[model samples]
Each structure stands twice: as structure tokens, then as C-alpha cells.
Target: MMGSERSRMLYERAHGLMPGGVSSPVRASEPFPLFIKGGKGATLFDVDGNRYSDYCLAYGPLILGHAHPRVVEALRKQAGEGTLYGAPTELEVEMASLISSLYPSMPMMRFVSSGTEATMHALRLARGFTGRSKIIKIEGAFHGAHDSVLVKAGSGAATHGTPDSLGVPEEVARNTLLAPYNDLDAVERLMREQGGQIAALIVEPVLGNIGPVLPREGYLQGLRELTSRHDLLLIFDEVITGFRLAMGGAQEYYGVRPDITVLGKIAGGGLPIGIFGASEEIMSWVSPLGKVYQAGTFNGNPMSMTAGLETLRELREKGHEGLFHNGERMRKGLQNVLDDLGLGYKVQGIGPMYQLFLGREEVWDRAGAMRSDATLFKRLYQGLLHEGVYIPPSQFETCFLSTAHSQADIDRALGSYEKVLRGLRP
Candidate 1:
């Protein structure tokens, strides 16, 4: 059994200082959350000196894994020069150019500090461009923490049993429309009724927040067609799926492009960053160039640029085929374990992202994902922790596989899953 005496003490100390004893709601675990000291590659070393094979990957950012030498070295060099400059730098130009090459849909983009800022700005730009007040968001697709997208949100909001936040005014929430994932007809119906009033439709192409639920065949293409037909902008929130799914993200992977693309997580190489982009005409609507008006002090910081540039270079050289193969290996192993144990749990994932719904039902949407047994998931979480493996504590969050994860790590994780799951079988 793993010892968490130090973690318990730390949690107690943190509880008085921070809400729920954590910086983020999703990090709050029952009993107490493990206080991690450091991580190298695919392993995390907790404060209690226990090492865990990590699949959470800091909630889907560390695509190159923790403290990659290349990224770290670059950050170190950048730190020696200067961390932040109020004025623009060549790093911004280079990074944007590189990203544009990968994501052809984004001919122009603006950098921000977080995914929330990216989505928030993108929506505002959409509203400004379309002269519409309302926007449509898929159910359980977590764009960010901003008020407009909070209604029926997923991730921490859904996991904590409050999908709709209290602080958001009814008027603000009203402007945001909700549609179920993989339901093209529903979106079409909404567009018909409120097409003129709606500014855009923002969606996570893979539904990473709600269990990495995949889109049905032609679902993304259907969305593209519907939005285009309605004259509403399409925003792909690739915060979780960005570089992890493919170098070009879900847009390139699925061959369906969005009018505006919001990218974070891996795009910054584990640094705090967000980017929203569109065509030249649409992008002209932002800042001094246009009426949308988006600005940030830390936008395109040198440190984040350095790390991101290095991370991208590593990815291009290494390629994602190895990661994809590992993902398939893990998923197949998980399914085999469930089958052998006569467990009816469903495994869902794409590329290096995955999740295990705690029931027989295959989840295709928010409602379907909600059918998973959270209670059983809590047990499984504790079991995995005891076995020295770590995944996101919330059932709603997705698990990630990083390039740092090796075949040995996958096999070890599978063994831990099998052992812990076998114990949980009743």
C-alpha cells in the first residue's frame, strides 16, 4: 500500500489557504490528493516518496511528458535572456507561422494565457463579426470557465454536480445554446430556429472532457456543413486534443476545418498559453486592426514560445505514430482485461487520449457519459492510487499518453489496472 501521510498533512495545510485544498477543483480527491513533488518522463514522484506511472499528464498538457530535456533546456536558455517583453518578439512570428503550417485553417491567430481566454475571445470575435448575440455549444463540451459557456458545462463543473454555475446571470446563460454531441439533426433544428441570432457553434471535435467520446462517422463534416449553411462561425475547441491527436489537431486529423480554432495544452508545451485563429478577413476583426478587441500582457511570452517551439520540433522529428500505437496497445489491453473479468465497462479513446466508462453502455454523448457509475469510479481511483498509478481523479476527465511513456510503462500500467480491477470485481 502507498503511504500518504505527507499528502494528508499537506492537504490539511492547503485547505485553510485555498478552496478545496487545491488550485483547481478537479485536483480535489476524496481522502486527500497526492501532493506531487516532481515528475520525469511518464512517472510522477509524490511528496510521500511514492512513484506513480502517470496517465493524467497534468490534465492533458504534457504531450512530451514531464520535464522533457529539450523543452527544459530551451526554457532555461530563454530564462537567461528575458521572460517577458511588453512589445512583440520574433518568437511570436515564428511560433504563429509554424502553427499555421500545421493548422492551415488558422491563417492568423492571437495568443492568450489560457484556453478560457482563447475560447472567450473567439466567441467575442464571432459575435462581433456576425453581429449576433447568441452562440451554440455542445452539451458537456467544456470550452472554458467564462460565464457564457458555463451552462451545462463538463469537466470540474459536471464532476462537482454543478454544470451551470450560480454567478452567471440568466441573460448571459440564455445567449448560449446547448446541443448534444453526435446529434446533427438537433444542431440543424437549432440553426433553423435561431440561425440569424447565433454567432457561432463551438465544439470539441473528440469530446475530451466528457470521456474522450468520439464523434460519429461524418459528425464533424456534418457540423461544418450545418454551420456554413447557417452562416454561423464554427469554432473547434482543441484545448485537450490539440497537438496530442495530431500535429494539425482534430481539424486536420478529421479533414474538417473550423472557421476559428482554439488551441492550448500542448501548443504551449506545458506552459500557460492559448491561441485562437481564423482566416485573414475574420482575424482582422481583432485588436487595433479590427473591432473585436483582444489583448493580453503575457500574450506570446518568450518562455512559452521557446518551450513550445522546442516541443514542436521534437514532435516533428519523433512523429506521433509511436504514441498512436501505444494508445491502441493500452486500449486493447484494457478491453481484454474487462472481457476476461466479465466486466462490462466501456473503453473509449482516439490517438493518445482515452477513458474507461464504468458501465456496459458505450458513451456517445453527455447523457451517455453521465450514465457511468461515479461511485465505482471513486473506488477504482483509490485502487489505482494504492497500486502506484495515477489518472485524473474525476471520471469526466480524459487520460493521456505522452511520448515519454514507454512500452514497459504501458505494460506496468496494464498490470496495475488488471490487479486493481480484479479486486474491485464483486
Candidate 2:
């Protein structure tokens, strides 16, 4: 058995100090979570001296892989200069320019600390711009922990939502409408019924939270048409998909554009960062420019800007093409292993991100993803862990590949997977 005695002891102590013994809910696992000592390239080393081939990639931020030399060198240089200045810097301007060049829809942007902040600010901007009070969100899409978006769909389809969390007030939840993802008819009906009150329709171009569920063909285009027709803003929560999907993100990959875009995760280069942007006319309503107020002390921290700028430059110079190719190679290899084992499982996702669902049906939305067998998934998780392949503990999370992962790394991972599956089968 893996020697996780140190991890177990640490968790026992942490359990008393932190809720569920983890700063984040997803970090907590049965028994105890592995305490990682460090990571380099595509591998992670735990406190117990166990080495794992990391497929989770720190929940999709390490696109270039852990502690990449360029990112580390950039951070080192920035730390030598200063970390945070709490004022404008040339680095921030450069970073913004790079992102804008890639995503022209966002001609201007404001930086914050997390994905939650980006989505929250975007929602507020949408409301301010339209002079409306309501917003429509995908049924199971997670935009962040903010109260306004922390909602669940009601009993009936395309109904007003209820607070998905304890602290969110019912009144706040009621202003948020929920519609099933990839269901244009449901979204259309909601807009027709509540068009006057609605400010915007926010969606994840590709659903990442529920294990990489993809959009139906023409679904995003359909949303753009509907929102334009109804005179409502369209917000793409690209927090998870940004940078990871492509240089321009899901909008570029799918050939669609949103009025306002929310970004985080990979853009931060493993640092905490969030960004929301729109055209000059729309963003004119923000801060000193106009009336919609938003400000943050760490809005454009030098360290984050340095990291993000370097990461983007590296991606453009040496990683983007290889990343796409490696991702497809890994996905096809995993699918082949499943085929060889005669397992009735479905693989979902696009580009460099993928997930193995313990179900046979193609998962195009949250409902189908949830139908995956959790019990079987738990066993696979445990088996993979024993084999030194560390994927996300939850079945409802996607696995990411990085430029650092070579063909050898993928082959090793496939070998581990095959061994685990063979042991599980009769």
C-alpha cells in the first residue's frame, strides 16, 4: 500500500482547523488527501515520497505543466523587482493587449482575484448596461461562489431558480433564471416569457464542471442569435475554458462571440487572477469612465501579470500546436484502452481536455453526465491512485494534458489505466 501516514496525520490535524480538512471542498477525499510536496513538468511528488503522473494539472491551470521553467523564471524575475504595487504597470497593459488581440470581442478588460469576481462583475455590468434585473444561467453551470449566481433550477423546466447554497437569499435566487444546457427551446421560452426583465444569458461555451460535457452543434450560435433578437447581453463564462480551449478560447474555437467575456484559470498561470471585458462602449460604464463601480486592490498585481504574460508568450512560441496534438493523442490512446477492455464507458471533451464517464451514452449536458456510475468511478479512482496516476478525485471533473507531457508520459498513463481496469474486470 502507498505510505500516506504523513498525509493522514496532517489531515487529522487540519480537520480540526479547517472545514472538511481542506481549504477547497474538492481537495478533500475519502481517508485523506495526498499532501503534495512539489510538482515539475507533468509529475507530482507527495510528502510520503510517492510520485504521481498528474493528469488533473492543478484543476486545469498548469497548461504548460507544473513549475515550467519559463513561468518560474518570469516569476523569479518579477519577485526580485516587486510582487504587488497596487498601481498601474506596463505589464498589465501588455497582458491586456495580448488577450485582446486573441479575443477581439473584449476590447477592454478589468482584472480581479478569482473566477467568482469576474463573473460577478460581468453580471453587474450586464445589469447596469441593460437597465434590467434578471439573468439567465445554464441549469448546472458554475460561475463561482457569489450569491447572485449560486442558484439551482426549480422543479419545472426553465423555471425561476432557488439558492443552491445556504447563505444566498431566495430573492437573489429568484432573479436568476435556469435553463437546461444545449436546450435552445427552453432558453427561447424563458426569454419570451421574461425578456423585459432579463439582463443577459450567461453560459459556459463547453461545460467543464460536469466532466467536460460538450455543446450540441450550433448551440452557441443559436444562443448568439437568441440574445441579439431579444436585445439581451450574452456572457460567456470562459473561466475554465479560456486559454485552455485555444489561444482565443472557446469563442475562437467555436467561431462565436459574446458581448462580455469572463476569464480566469489558465490565464493566471497558476496565480490567482480574474478578468472581465467588453467593447469600449460597454466598458465605458465601468469605474472612472462611467457609473458602474468596480475596483480591487490587487486588480493588476505585477506578479500575476508577469506570470500570465510569460505563459501566453510561451504558448504562442512553442506550445499551442504541440498541446493540441498531444491532447488528441492521449484521448485516442485512452479510448483505445477502453475499447480493448470491452468497457462500456464514454469519453467526452474537446481539444486537450477529456473525461472518462462510467456510462455508455454520449454526455452532451449535465443530466447525461450525472447518469454516470459513481460507484464504478470511485473504484477506478482508487485503482488509478494505486497505479500512481492521479486524476481528479471527483467523477465530475475533467482531466487536462499539458505541453510538458510527452508521448512516453501518455504511454505510461495508459499502461497504468490498463492494469487497473484489467484488475477490476472478471
Best by TM-score: 2
Candidate 1, residues 179-233, lDDT tens digits: the string is 8899998889889998999999999999998779999999999999999999999
**In model 2, which regions exceed 4 Å deviation?**
154-157
Model 2 — TM-score against the truth?
0.97
TM-score of 1: 0.97
> Residue by residue across 89-162, what tens digits does model 2's lDDT show?
99999999999999999999999989999999999999999999999999778898998888866575246577
RMSD of each: 2.7, 1.4
Which clashing pairs does model 2 show? none
Candidate of highest lDDT: 1
Task: List ranges where model 1 is wrong by over 4 Å.
Answer: 153-163
